[model samples]
Every structure is written in C-alpha cells, then in structure tokens.
Target chain A: MFVQATESSTGVSHDVARLGRLVRGLPETALVVDAITGLGTTDLQPDEWGLDIVIGGSQKALMVPPGLAFLGVSEKAWKLIERSKLPRFYFNLARERKAQSKSEVSFTPATTLVVALHTALEYIRSMGREKLIANAAMLAEATRAAASALGLGLFAESSPANALTAVSAPAGMDSGAIIKELRARFGAIVANGQGSMKGKIFRIAHLGYYDAPDMFALIASLEIVLTKLGHTCELGAGVARAQEVYLGFVEQEAQAAQAGRP
Target chain B: MFVQATESSTGVSHDVARLGRLVRGLPETALVVDAITGLGTTDLQPDEWGLDIVIGGSQKALMVPPGLAFLGVSEKAWKLIERSKLPRFYFNLARERKAQSKSEVSFTPATTLVVALHTALEYIRSMGREKLIANAAMLAEATRAAASALGLGLFAESSPANALTAVSAPAGMDSGAIIKELRARFGAIVANGQGSMKGKIFRIAHLGYYDAPDMFALIASLEIVLTKLGHTCELGAGVARAQEVYLGFVEQEAQAAQAGRP
Candidate 1:
C-alpha cells in the first residue's frame, strides 16, 4: 500500500516506521513497496524500516533534471519477481538491478542528467541528511507562520509539509491569475492547487537549496499579489512572522548542538 | 504511440497527419494519453494531430530539474471527466487545467525547477526552434560519424535518434567500468547501456546548449577510453570524422536555404 505524501515532508521518520509495522502485520510473507513520494525530500532508510523496495527519481530533493529513477529492492521482492508475470520492458526492475550492480543502467540513461544528479548528490552528502531535513522543516515552519500572518489559510492544516507550503486563495481571486502574474511580472513562479482545490489555493516551495532569504523574496511577491487582488492584510507582517520562526529554529538547532556535549 | 526522441537537447518533428491516422485506427478511445517518451524533446502538436492529450516533464528538452510533469489536453479529453475513473489525486489533469488557465500549477510545483524551466524555455525561444533542432541533429550526426570512424557499432541501426548516440562496447571491456573510469579520472560522464544492453554498449548525449566542440571533446574521451581498454583504433580518426560531419552539416543548411530562394 502506497501512502501518498500529501504534506508530511518533515521526514518520513514516523510515517515510514508506521507503514513498516502495518505492512509487516499483514499475513503475506513479503511486502513490496514504492517509496517514491517523499524519499529524497524526507529522511528515509529502507533498511531500517524493512521496506522491500524504495524507488527514487533524480528530480525533487535530489535537485537535478528528470530522466533517471533509482530503486532499491530487498531479497524477498527479488524472489517474487521470478514468478511474477507483468509485461515489463522499459521500467524493468530486474534488469536495472543487474546493471546497477556493475555501476551501469539498463538503457541509454540520460547522461547529462546523471552528471547533474551526481553533482547534486555530492552536495547533499556534504550538507548531511539530518541538517537537510532540519533546514527543510525550518523553512516550512517559517512559511506557514508567514501565511497565517497574511490571513491566508493553510491548505494542509493538519499535517503541514516541509517540502512546500499550500495556502488558500483569497475570496474570489483566481490562484492561476496570481501565479501567472508572478511569472510574467516578478518572474517568480509558485504552484496552484491540485485536484478538488484547483484555483482555490497556491503553494510556495522551500525544499532544496533554499534559505530564509528565499522565503522573504517569496513573501514579498505574495504581498504584491494579495495587494493587487485587494486582499486586506498588513504589509511586511507575513515576512516578520516568518523571520521569527526562522530565528526560533536557528536557536533551537544551536541549543541542540550545545547540549550534545562531548 | 509515443516515440522516444534521440535528440537529447531538443525535440524532433513528427508527421502529425500520419500519427492522427494511427490513433484513429485504435479500437477504443484512449482516456489518458501519456506522451511521456517524446513530448518535451520533440515538437508535437497534439491538438492538430487528433491527440487527446500531450504530456511533458520539466527535464529533457525543457532543460530544468525533473520533478514537474506537464500535461496539455484537448476539448475531447476534458469530456472524459464524466465517465473516466483513475485513482489520481496529484496528477489530475482537470484540476491542473483549471489552475493553469490562471497560470498556476495544481500542486506544490518544484520552485527551483520552475524557475530553471522558465529560463530554459526563454533561452530556447531566443535561439529559435528551427535553429535549435538543427543544432541538435548536427551534433548527433557528428557524434555518430566519429564513433563509426573508431570502428564502434551504432546501437540503433534503424531510425537512429538524434537525441543521443548509443555505441557498442569493445570486445573485451566492460562499458560500465569504462564509464566509471571516465567519470572518476577525467570528470567526463558518458552513459552505459541500460536494461538488456547493460555493459554491452554505451551512449553519448549531444543535446541542450552543446555544440560541435563539445562533441569533439566527447569523441576525444572515447579515444582515451578505447586506448586504455586495449582496443586498437586510429588516434585522430574520430576527431577527423566529427569535423567532417560538422562542416558538411553547415554546408547543407546553407545550400538548403539558398535553394529556397524564389
């Protein structure tokens, strides 16, 4: 069973472990999984969770062009593959496994993309996984506080995601129009709502390679958009709230490090 | 019938009328047409070709980080909403369309990627579509000729793609190992055979913002790889062949324009 990562990007730490227990509780001897959604953006360890298969695409938290999808499979899943019969050609996991063992791919892999992926991964490694997750979560907290200050409702109110922030559009204002204006005017591009919420909300990403300043720029543009749409809210209020959240996170991080005395 | 493009840097032009005829011949109406393999790299007018939808991702020819996928649907596709049922929440087309009309995305679109894509698209527009395609094709031709001169076999014997060139691995060397060494020692990343052809062949990409000189550099790397692998081939043959192809392409383009004169 695939657990869609709607807005739980802080780290799959809790959900993934819960999923592992649930899957293992089933009567089946083995379980196969596709952990593509929040794999890179969140902290994930397939081995730790006993996940059978963990798939990842080169984009997203990996910070590279698409074209490459990486998968990690367990021994139990490997055995089932011999008996399973599904028409597989391009996305053949078996062949990919064999090739990847020798540091290769199963087809004409996207070379340039792989190069960029390599570079991006190197960056991730240098930053450290724990720090990356912390950074993403901090950004999310800051953005959420800022959105609240602007009187914009958080779309995913219950379980906020660190990958991005989704805020409801003001009454009668088209989310698409705001997005278009951002692109056309300020050259800032944000996301709109999906599925049932289309045109009702917009999203701001603060995932990879982003910081407090990035959030400020985004909030500034958002203020312009909200003002243009006649949404009454105090200017700079949102940014100030976000700044406070950011400062709190930094302080907490410093305290944690200090408490871990040698 | 989504055809994969060989031109890694750009999209190719397919005969729209013929494709329309092929789709019309199908027994049932395809609900969600996934043009995943070719849309971004090739120039396709789904609306004109009787296609219900056209899909693309931010990477490939779009020249952006890969997390975003794009879909363009026709009027007929929109009509499928009443009867169609696919378990889709994130990649829902209708909701995205509604939001897109206002120039927004249906979900938390990758901000960094969106920014990069916008930059890439504008860059393409500046280069002009015709010039971009021509440049991509020319680079592919140069790569193929150079590889051929070095006694390397082309992987795709028929309808070889202009996106990238796939070459057979030499008799006694592992293409994957060769790839690793090239990347590790020289900082040049070439691709190894994917899927069924793993370790049997290698691929070289000549797309997006690359030129003949870049292709020349790749060919030189190939020579070094071959020599180190104990494969006997003329030292400068590949480079010479690449130069000839580049020169020939420029001449042909000039001649074609001249012939178009009234």
Candidate 2:
C-alpha cells in the first residue's frame, strides 16, 4: 500500500504512524510512503514505524535541483520484491540495492548531482538530520504565527506541513495577485496552489536553504504584497510575529540543553 | 525479440539488418535493439527496419559523462508495453512517454547530467551524426590496420566492431602484460578482455572523442609496449599503416563528396 507522509499539494501532513499500526498485522501488505516533501522537514522513522518503503526526492528539503529520487526499503519489501513478477525494466530495486552495497550503481548515474547531494548530505549529517527537521518545524511555526498575526487564513490550518505554509486569500481576492505582486515587487517567487487549489492559496516554502532571516524577509515581503493586492494587513505584524517565534524557539532550545535533555 | 547492434564485449558487430529481416514475418513480436555502443559509432535505422525499441547510453559515442540512457520506442513497442504485465516500477515507459510528449518527465531527472547530455546531443547534431559514425569507423579501420602491421591477431577479424578493435595476445604472451606495460610506459590505458576473454585479448576503443592523431599515438605506444613485453615488431610499421588508412579514408570521403553523394 502506498501512503503519502506529507501531502505537498494540500499542505497537510499524513498520520504515517497510524498507517503503520493499521497494517502491522498484515504480513502480505507493504506500506510504501511517499515522503518526498516529508523526509527532511518531518520527523519520520520508517523502520521503527514498520514502513516497508519510503520514497524521497532530491529537490525537496534536500535543497538540490530536481533529478534524483531516494528510496529506503525494509527487509519485508525486499522479500516481497524478490517474488514480484513486475518487469523492473530500468528501476530494478534489487539490482540497485546490490550495486549500492558495493558503492556502485547498476546503471549510469547523475555524477554531478550525486556529488552535490553528497556535499548536501554531508552538511546535513554534520548538523544532524534531526536539527534540519527541527529547523523546518520552527520555520513553519513562525510562518503560521505570522499568517495568524496578518489575519490570513491558512489553507491547512488543522495540520499544516512543516515543508511549507499555505495561506488562503481573503474574501474576493485571487491568490495569484498576491503571488505575482511578491515576485514583481521583491523578486521572491512563491508557489501557488496546484490543480483546483490554484488562485485560492499561495504557498511559502520553509524547507531547504531557509533560516530565521529568510523567513523574516519572506514574511515581510508577503505583508507588503498582500496589502498591495488590496488585502490590507498590519504593516509589520507578520515579520514581528516571525521574530518572536525565532526568539522563543532559541530560548526553548537553551532551556532544553540546560535541563540535560539529549 | 531483442538484438544487439554491436557487441562491445568481444568487439564484434552483429548483423542487425539481418535480424530485422528474420523477425519481419512475426507480426506479434517486437524487435528490441541494444544500441548503446552502436548509436553514434554505427549506422542504425530503427524506424525503417521496424525495430520496436532501440536503447542507448550517454557515455558511449555521444561524448557525454555517464548518467543517462536513451530509448527509441516505436508504435509497436508502445502497444506491447500497454499489454505488458511487468510492473515497470520506476522505469515506467508509458508514464515517461506521456510526460515526455509535453517535454516533461514523470520522475525526478538528473538535472545536471541531463543538461550535459543536452549540450552533447546539440553538439552531435550540429556536427551531423553520420559524420560521427564515419569517424568511428575510420578510427577502427586505422586501428585494425595498425594491429595487423604489428602482427597482432584481430579477435573479431571476420566482423570487427566499428566501436572498438580487439587484438589477441601474440603466442603465449598474456594480453595483461601488454596492457600494463603500455600504461606504465606511456600512461595509455586500454581495456583488458572481460570474463573468459581476460588475459587473452585487449581492446582498443575507437569510439567517442578519438581521431587520427589519437590513433597514431595509441598504436605507437602499443608497438613499444609489445616489444618490452618480449614481443618484437617494427617500431614505425604500425604508425605507418594507420597513417595509410587515415589517408585512404580521407581520399574516399573526398571522392564520395565529389561524386555528389550526401
């Protein structure tokens, strides 16, 4: 069974832990999670949660240009894959796994991107993967606080994704106008809602290569653009809220360290 | 049905045209061709010969780093693919084809290598693909002539591949010795025989990025290495024969051009 750890299109996070529990007793079932948007930003434990497979992409929170996908497979998945009649064609997982064991690939690989990914992964490792995920969560919290302060209704208010924050346009306003204004005025391009959600909500990413400063700048820009597009808001409310979130987060970290929490 | 346009293993060229003819009577069968080493170095016509699919790689003859694979799928192949029960996994040709029709990819592609491949393909197109193939053939011809002059037995004498030429070890001499000696003496590394053919024959590639000067240098190095390894041959004889082949090919090309052949 395939599950999405985070639904990027809707800016909602999936209850992946519940999914593992739902299929724990089924020996034949394999839970494959699409964690492309979740891997770096969300705290995911595929193995501990008994997920059979988790898929990720390079361009998401990994902060690289698009072109590679990563897969984390459980032993159960491998066993099932061995018996699978599916003609693997080019994406032969078994072949890839065997080759990867030897630090080789079954087929040609993107050398340059792999090198870039190596550097990024090394950096992530140095900083700790958990830290990266925490960074995303902090950014998301800040963005959410700013959105609330600016009187913007968030699209996924109940369970907003850490990868990005989606803010819904106010009454009678198209999100496209805000999106265009942000790009035109500040040269900062944000994502619009995909498919049917288009023109209803604009998304602000807080994933890879983003920090507290970037969030501050983005939130500030959003405020100006929203007002210019006729959706008036408090001039400095968004940035101010984000700054408060940052300061609060730093204090929490310090308190946790002082408390000797590993 | 599947066939190879050229077998890089033993440096033998397959009669792909004959294979196409042999399978012409089988309407339900789709002939697939592996043209990885053959693509830019050999003349192949997948459309005309009713080949259902032709596979190629970026590093072979295309003058690009290894990262991408190319496939030419005919209408028959698509029809066959539609009926195929094999789970395509990541190598879903149908999904890829649909996306590619609009110049989009279904999966994350290696962005940097794709860019590199695009640049290499553009260069190949500007130079004309036929010229590249002819150049390979000319280099192979020169290498073959040189090998013969040096008293080295051609492994694929009857059907030598245009991609590369394989030369057998001379009388009780292991091909590995000559390969090592050449590398040690001149820093020129040639491929040793694979699998069962190892220690018996060594391969000299005449494919991508190779020209007359390269061939001359390679052959001269081989002559010295062979002598050092207890095999003796006239030093300038191999180079002279290669020069003759180079001149002959140029004259033939000029004559063909003058005769209004495209």
Candidate 2 achieves a global lDDT of 0.87
What DockQ do you compute for every candidate structure?
Answer: 0.09, 0.54
- Expressed as tens digits, the lDDT of each residue in A173-198 for candidate 2 is 99899888888888988888977999
lDDT of 1 by residue, A1-262 (tens): 5554424332222366667666765544444454444554566666677666676766566766545667777776777675568656765778778888999666655556677878988898998877777777888888889888998888777767677778888888888988988887788988777667779888887667777898898898888878887888888999999889988988998899899987
lDDT for each residue of candidate 1 in B75-98, tens digit (9 for 90 to 100): 666776535786566656777778
Off by over 4 Å in 2: A21-26, A82-86, A89-91, A100-103, A170-181, A257-262, B21-27, B75-94, B101-103, B169-187, B257-262
Residue A64 shift from truth in candidate 1, angstroms: 1.2
TM-score of chain A of each: 0.89, 0.96
Please give the CA lDDT of all the candidate structures: 0.71, 0.87
